[model samples]
Target: MVMEFPLLEGLSPVERREFIAACTPRRFRRRDIVCHEGDPGDCVHLITGGRLVVRVTTPLGHTATLTILGPGDMFGEQALLSPDARRTATIVAVTDATTLTLNRSQLERLRLQHPQVERFLTTSLAAQVRRLSASVLEALYLPVETRVLRRLAHLARVYADGAGTPALINLTQEDLASMAGTTRATANKVLRELEDQGVVRLSRGAVTVLDPAWLATRAR
Candidate 1:
C-alpha cells in the first residue's frame, strides 16, 4: 500500500522505498481529531487503513461533513506546498485510522532531492483545484435531494467494499443533511421517500442503500 499512492507514481522502486521509510506512522481512535481547522498545515497524510471524516465546524458550531476518506487516499497535501497556510478543514477519525505522516520540513528536503515528487505534487494540486471548482458549482445549482444522493453515490465509490446496493454509510442523518447542505427535517423527508422506494434503509445512525445503481440514476 505504501507504493500505491499517486504522489509516488513517478518514483522508481528504490525511490519509493526511501520515501516510505521517511514517513512516520500515526494512529487514531474513532472520533479523534486528527487535525483541527485553522491549525498550521504542518504535514501531509496518507491513509494506510480505516476511514476519516473531513469536515468544517462554523463559528456557530455547525459541523458540515465535507467528505469521507478511506485507505489509499491522501489529504493535508495543501500544506506541503504552502507550509504557513491555515488548515482548510478539520479531519476526524470516523473509525480507527492509521496514516503515514510526513512533515513539511521532510517534504521540502525531499522536494529538493526528488524533482519527480515536486512535479507530482504540482500536478496533483492542480487537479484538486479543478475538482473543488466543479463541486462548488454543483452545490450551488443541484436540488437538495439530488445533492444528498450525489454525496451518497460518491461516498459509496470511495468507501464501499462490495458491489451494488446496501452500501453501508456510517453517518448520522444529521451528517448527511450537513453534507447535502439542507436542513435535517428535509433530509429526513427525502430519505424516508427513498426508503419507500426501496433505495435506502435507515437505521439508528447508519444508512444502507439498497440500490446504489438505481440511486445513481435518480441522482443524475
Candidate 2:
C-alpha cells in the first residue's frame, strides 16, 4: 500500500519528525473527497499512505485531472504562504489510506520554526512550477492521445521503483480521458492502440506498461 511513495529525501530526520508531530493523522476510504474546489484553503495534507487525484471542473461541466499524488507528497502548502488563497482543485483519495493534516496556521508556524521545512516547501514548489508549466503547454499544444500517453508515462515513472520495475497505474478509462481532456471512448481507443502495439497491457482499471520506451516515445 505504500508503493510509489514520493521521497522527501532532502529533509533531515529531525525536521521530518517535527513536521509529522505538528500534523494530525487521519484515514480516508477509497474515493473520499479530501478537499473541494473553491473551498477555503485550511489544511495542508501530507500523504503518508495513499494516492490522491487532483481535478478541476470547467464551466461546461467537463472535468480535467491536473495530477495524481502519492505518499510522501504534500499539497495545499501554497495556502500557508498566501493569506487569501482558496483551493484551486478538488482532491479525492484514490485508495483507502492515511494522511497527516496540518491547518494553515500550524503549517505557517512550522515554516517559521523550521528552516528545513521551508527548504522542503521551496523544493516542492519548484517542482510544481515546472509541472504546471508543462501542463499548460500540453493542454495548449499536444494532441489528446499524446497528452494521455504523457500522463501514462508519468504514472509509470512515478509508480516504478528507482530500479525501473514497472507497476500498474490503477485508473479507469474515464479517469484517463478526464486527465487528457478527451472523451472516454477516445481514451479507450488510444489505450487499445497502445496495447495492440505491445506498449501497454490493460486490465480493468489497471494499465501496465509493457514497453516503456514505446510509451515514452508517444508521450513526446
Task: Write one digit per residue (lDDT tens) for candidate 1, span 181-216.
Answer: 888898899989989988888899988877878877
Largest lDDT belongs to which candidate? 1
Worst 10-residue lDDT window for candidate 2 reads: 1-10
What's each prediction's TM-score? 0.87, 0.80
TM-score of 2: 0.80
The count of backbone overlaps in candidate 1 is: 1
How well does model 1 score by local distance difference test?
0.82
Off by over 4 Å in 2: 1-11, 158-166, 217-220
Q: Give the per-residue lDDT of model 2 (tens digit) for 1-220.
A: 2232243556677767777788898899999999899998877787877678899988898777867877767788777667777998999988786898877677678778786777766776887798789878988988887988987887776566457666678888888887787788999999999889888889988888877877777677
